[model samples]
Target: MAETLATYEVPEHHVKMYTANVQAALNKEGGILTPLVSSNAYTGEKSQVVNFIGEVEFVERSTPYGDTKVTELEHTQVWISGREYDCAVFIDRLDTLKMIYDPTNPYVERFREAAARKMDEIIMSKFFADRKVGKDGTSTSAFGSANTVVHGNTGLTVAKLRSLRKLIKKRHVKVRTVRPKIAVTAEDVDNLLGEVAVTSADYAAIKPLVDGEVSSFMGFDFIPYEDNGGTSGDGKSIPSFQDSGSVVRQLPVWVPDGMHFGQWDGLTIKISDRADKNHIKQIHGTFTAGATRLEEGKVFQVQSKNAA
Candidate 1:
């Protein structure tokens, strides 16, 4: 049998333009974990699992005068897998021509903003799902559960932040620096303000509380979510510090290298014409990516009680 070709031909120049536009938009989306972990790439559509090797501890032994004891380095593996993300923008023939002619087109900017938001959301959701939760234990030894779980649901405050840092230290989570990542919903912003009175004499230095510039607090790289309550396609809101039935879960704290994001090599923009006689042009942005928890021990969940 003969192959049926596409009805309309997409010009080389148009395809190039699509590629440039999509790439520029993707570059504008800055995600939290994108810089913290090492990135990897794969070739195929199926999920690719990579092994993460853990550190080995060496022991000191006393030997005979002329004899020596020898030992080999040992390590453990944590497996991680990633998938692809794809999105398409459809434009009518007239609209496409307008975009080509108008350098300051609002349409292009709107499209770029939407694409950037989606890119960030995908990475954040993956980060939330690929972590370990902590429990209400006095120390790290008595905390932790499976399925990307962490403990602590009490609201955010300076003292609670210190407790989280102490828990992280107790776990001996080796970190390159003193900073840990902490995310909070906009609603929690008010909770934090209540802890520090805005009318006090110290409010001058604590103005981030009033102006909303509190990027770091209590040794955490504070990440405030403008909208943490919206639901995804699966009917679940973007995972933030929230309550689960009787147990309330607090935010996450971690070392930079504890997680990783892997991307496929040939991430690009694809352009084509519609098969239907509508004369619509399709611009697609596609890339393959996966995230995994490299060292569960390096990440901690802070379990908190409901503020009464």
Candidate 2:
């Protein structure tokens, strides 16, 4: 059955909840097919912010001349030391999320291709590409969009039907939920339901705005330890100051918000173009949920390395 959402209205005390069930469904190293990170939280026109988030640690070693070259390599193991990453979630005013139920709408046949592109754009911009525009509207991709597509087959494959069975596979993006209310809201929405991507709001509280107030204050924390005592990168216990306030705090991006009550919109989509193509390639991810729905209760706890 089709679900109806209110017309672009922000609930006074309600916060928006958008959870993406991220899974590396299929990956290719040689790049026979292009990989697009999918999440409903991105715009189809540009790239999403890709962050190589981790921590830095140094070990004391000696050199031949009795001199030490203190090398530092980032460790992605912040969670092991009870530490959260410093991350932020920024929203694009350009991307859009609208449910299409009109049967005569030609786009429905392609299986939410626009939504998938939006997801890819969001991930690529953040994790891979930064931004892709200016007033003149030019692509800002590092090497450009064509660069992301490393492998391009020039000639059509000439093979027997029997021999191609192993190579040919079905393509589809089917999100199954009894109700279809998969929508996303801006970060400004306070007290949102479901999980969230948070960042520090450059606060100038002294000179406040007249209409709205910035509410959803979020952050993260970790037990960062120096070689304070133990030989094994043992970080001493530290206070929880994840991302907010500009202190030496943890920048927690996926700050779970609101109660996981009512029918939830697990994924978000920001449509920028109408994809009328037949072929599809997508990249997708989620915060801590590896082939699993994050129980609303699980957000507050420091357990579960939800990665696959």
Candidate 3:
């Protein structure tokens, strides 16, 4: 049978667009990933604001007069479970128009272009674009409509898909995520905010960045939900994702290079104190992969140059 472009079926480009955009948006970024740094890169920056506080409630309260204040208690504090993404934007974008669209009667093409633009707006603004966006905001390469998938298109202007393929296939820098996680004792959290503080605190810390240099380490924190005295699958209420620390904070990160992918035999990270050794205190750091709940193959691996 002669092969054809299938938007929703075999190599469906349409389905791929939505899935790719959605996963990349949620998994990594929050909005339009753009290249404020690179002119137009395969990867871009993403900004996300994690919740600083979880659910809270008013405790049993009692009012007392000035004389009775000494005899009556006022109220107490309590904390609820769960985590919050709060508000964050992930930015992602293509460097140039990969697909071709007719400009004369460019309604659909215009919409695709518009989507790209709106994505840029949302990312830059660090705001969530209501989920009312349509295909009009998306665009396809010269191959065909963004609604179409099946990367194999031979009927169009470019009979030689090989040439177009070469254009998009190149090794470039990657915009990856930095989710910092650490193991802590319940006592550690109490030490951070003090005993009277009962509410949960979710935090995000983006380190100070200098132009041209890689970013300083960042830290993120979340409340760990627990059940039946456990906290893994059932979302057991374990230690909070981000805890407060008095002395040296324990913020660990697994920096996945946005540019490299393949049979990665191993990964390594180097650390040196950025602050004045006398003022900020010199510190050393190490790296290691934590236990992941994801099953192998469930992870999405972007293809790297010459990576089979």
Best by TM-score: 1
Whole-model Cα lDDT per candidate? Answer: 0.53, 0.21, 0.22
Give the alpha carbon lDDT tens digit for every residue of 216-239 in model 1: 655666555444355532112234
Tens-digit lDDT track of model 2 for 16-124: 2111111111111211101211122222222222222323467565665776665564322110001111112222221222322233232332323333333222221
CA lDDT, candidate 2, residue 60: 65
- Count of backbone collisions within predicted model 1: 17
**What is the overall TM-score of model 3 with all chains considered together?**
0.17
In order of appearance, the predictions have TM-scores of: 0.71, 0.18, 0.17
Select the stronger candidate by lDDT from 2 and 3: 3
Off by over 4 Å in 1: 1-10, 57-61, 64-75, 93-115, 127-143, 146-153, 174-178, 198-214, 228-250, 303-308
Rate residue 102 of model 1 by lDDT: 43
Best prediction by lDDT: 1
Q: What TM value does model 2 have? A: 0.18
lDDT of 3 by residue, 1-308 (tens): 64222111212353234333433332233212222211111111121111112224454446553333233332221111111111111111111111212122222233333333333332222111111111331321121121121212111112212232222232211213333222222333333323213433311111111111122221322221112244222222221122222122121111222111111111111212223322221112111111111111111111111101
Better of 1 and 3 by TM-score: 1
lDDT-wise, the better of 1 and 2 is: 1
